[model samples]
Target: MSYTIPFPRTALLAALGVACLAAGGARADAVPAAQRPVGEVTMSVGPVTRTTAQGLPEMVRRGTPILPGDRLDTADGGHLHIRFIDGALVSIRPGSRMLVEDYKYDPQRVSASLVRFKLEYGVARAISGAAAEGARERFRLNTPLVAIGVRGTDFVVRAGELTTRAAVNQGAIVMAPFGADCTAQALGPCGSSSAKLLSADMGQLQVEFRPQLAQPEIKPLQGAVFATNSTPENGSTVVAARSVAAAPAPAAPALGRTDSERLATAALADGAVTAAISGQAAAPVPPPAVTPPPVVITPPPEPPPVVAVPEPTIPLPPPVLAWGRWAGVAAGDGDIALPRAEAADGRSVTVGNAQYNLYRASDGQTELARGLGSYQFALDKSAAQYSLAGSVSPATVEQGRLLLDFGNARFATDLRVANALTGAVGISGAGAIRGDGIFFDRSVAGQAIAGAAALDGKSAGYFFEKAVGAGTLSGITLWSRP
Candidate 1:
């Protein structure tokens, strides 16, 4: 079975009404319901405190509901995890302060869902939940110098004094400079400019904020050491110019005077000042010298090249997949294959644009019962597959499981299983389930399982599989309940 909680508009309005009355105002009914609790703390370790809108700080316990306007501060060793109603998981690392600025979730009503957070300091990891996937551009993370927009993936963000670093573990994120709307000459209303899109395969990026710089400097993060002093000016011009120019003709360092010479000069200037103050005659200073203009000499133009050079070669574009369709093959004995059957009605979930069909099967062949409905499958751009963690319904096969592995030219499936009583499990076999009607050249051996889960009462077998390879599975019945 599957379910979705509707947005509590009345409760939110009532809360606003109470707040307005407490503030000695009668316009509580005019307040919007956007500032409401959209999630709660599912896990907490050590001392995690939350400051309420009333300016009161309180310790956060497990299952504590978090609302908009709530400020969360974690102690040095404290950790916190917030699970939003839309299934997004946010893990707050130690010594971090975060604010749930605004959140709205209504799966049935896409326009009503939005999520936004502000990380004042410290680190936080966000796994895009159902709400984020559906809301798309409406989801964002605000930092000191930039605002990040998610694309249904897991990502880590670290906020610091000098820079903000974002690493995509899965999917991609777009980051734009904060308050970029105002003209560089005038700091006024906040606006947006072009954003930088970062992919997980490209590692991480560090956004360095500098004084007098209109835009933040973004560079590939090398290691733990962040380039704080690196700016656009230094990166493209100053540093490159210095590297290319010949070593300054071996001239003496500028202003290389001795301490004695400096002291004597200071003393003479002091004496002159004293004489001028006293209206008396002082030593006459030497007049400045006139600089001589250099005589110009014209040089002969270089002779034409003796030999003609061949034109440079233009590289060809990479080969693209045709993405044609193929019919399923019947499995002989010992061969693995999905049974030919229509998906059970009402047993599926849609996350973003992908819908998963849950199914239950016995011995990987005998269909038992299909799940009541489909569950959302959030796409992980980094892995190029749907995330299985925290999935509402995961397919079951024999004593093992069928896992999806998507890539550029192959759609591979792996059989993984574990003992329920002893907790012993391992991946038994893997192969390319579909491709360009050819044996997948890529090695399937040694491919690690992205994730796995046990088949429980709440677990269902069915999920929407988005094709990443040379084929399309888009809405096909990969697995389903009886």
Candidate 2:
């Protein structure tokens, strides 16, 4: 028997059917590939793996296409290099995790391209591509505490559990606190209206974040050790604004020896000889002793002996080695950043490689070193190396310090304790090196000495002997000239 449903029941059933249809329609409209692939893995070494947006995980291999929302994880010794369609390159180091949050590039319509990256942990190096050059302000990298805006430059970034660090190799980058829309043109909420711009000079710009601090701190990349206080204290929320001023031009060179000698000869001929001869020659023409003006020879009060003031001494420049590219590495337990006390269980370590183009200006006083290289680390049984490049202009050899720049990185050490040999060199001091997505602070007595020289004129050596708690956590580095 047919029965008519109540009006309310009929209406509810109709409503449910409509809702189902709407949900089905929404599902059909969702296109997974619409976002497009931003880049592909060009190089993968050791144990690199990735997790796709579909929640599927697999080992990463060369040529693997990477899309937004994909997460990459590198194990000890694992290294991954990605080249985006827009020509950007990113190198991921070992024991690190990163995510390609979003990336869109349209060669024809460059203005609409966008790039976004999330560094969950570990280190990575990035070289700006078309997106940075075309859509200069649309690229962003997010870390635990900061968001970095790209400005068509190269840079390195490291994200740790308690801290985040960034170094600019070529070009420049702007950083702001998390959740802030920091851009190359705008500082957003994290920066004051008068925030200073950070740019790359002969040294790399460094920005660091601490949990207890409200804003990040900026400084030149000086490789020195930083002491952490374990005591819990109230956190401060004040952010300091800073900018790097342009360096002054080098001073003019001192007068050449040839020029000084010529001037001296002229002076002697013009006055010294003439005066001496006149005094020695008798009053020949007694010149009409005219006035013989009385014995006015009362000899005015004897004038005090003219006291001559000594001229200030100008320091001579230190003897410098040849100006060209020198490549090497510093490896040892001290290369590890962890405190020795905390590293009870042995932690894996790897080597680092560096190249420097040491140059001296005609002034004999001005010197500089432009460097580029990579650091490999093996932590938790995973190994990987990240790329880095920078320069240290005017690398002066002064009484107090020796500063070295590697594009977006820098190193500063005490010159007093540094020794240079034909094929080997050693430096020890309370110094630090920042850049290449890493921050290292050497202890007061920490020393880095390399002695072994290869037949190719390269040096393979170790660094760090007095690291606080990094038990045997050292680094090995190879320096090459090519």
Off by over 4 Å in 1: 1-36, 182-194, 203-218, 222-482
**Could you tell me every candidate's TM-score relative to the true structure?**
0.38, 0.39
For candidate 2, which ten residues in a row score worst on lDDT? 378-387
Tell me the tens digit of each residue's lDDT in model 2 across 1-482: 22121123234223222111111344633745434566777778899999987889999987777888899999988988777777777888787899887787778899988787889878788878787789876787777767777666777777776677776656777766542223333321234321224556636447665432224666556332111211121121234779989999999989666866667544343344666778863333333445544564565788789999999999984322111212233222223222322221222111111221112122221112234433222111111121113211111112222233344344444322121211112334422232211223423332222212111112222233222222211222223333
Error of 1 at 455 (Å): 64
Q: Write the per-residue lDDT of candidate 1 for residues 132-167, one digit (tens) a residue.
A: 787676777877656777777676777765456676
Indicate the residue-level lDDT of 317 in model 2.
Answer: 48
Candidate 2 wrongly placed segments (more than 4 Å) = 1-35, 179-196, 202-204, 223-482
Candidate of highest lDDT: 2
On the 0 to 100 scale, the lDDT of residue 406 in model 2 is 42
Cα error, candidate 1, residue 206 (Å)? 5.2
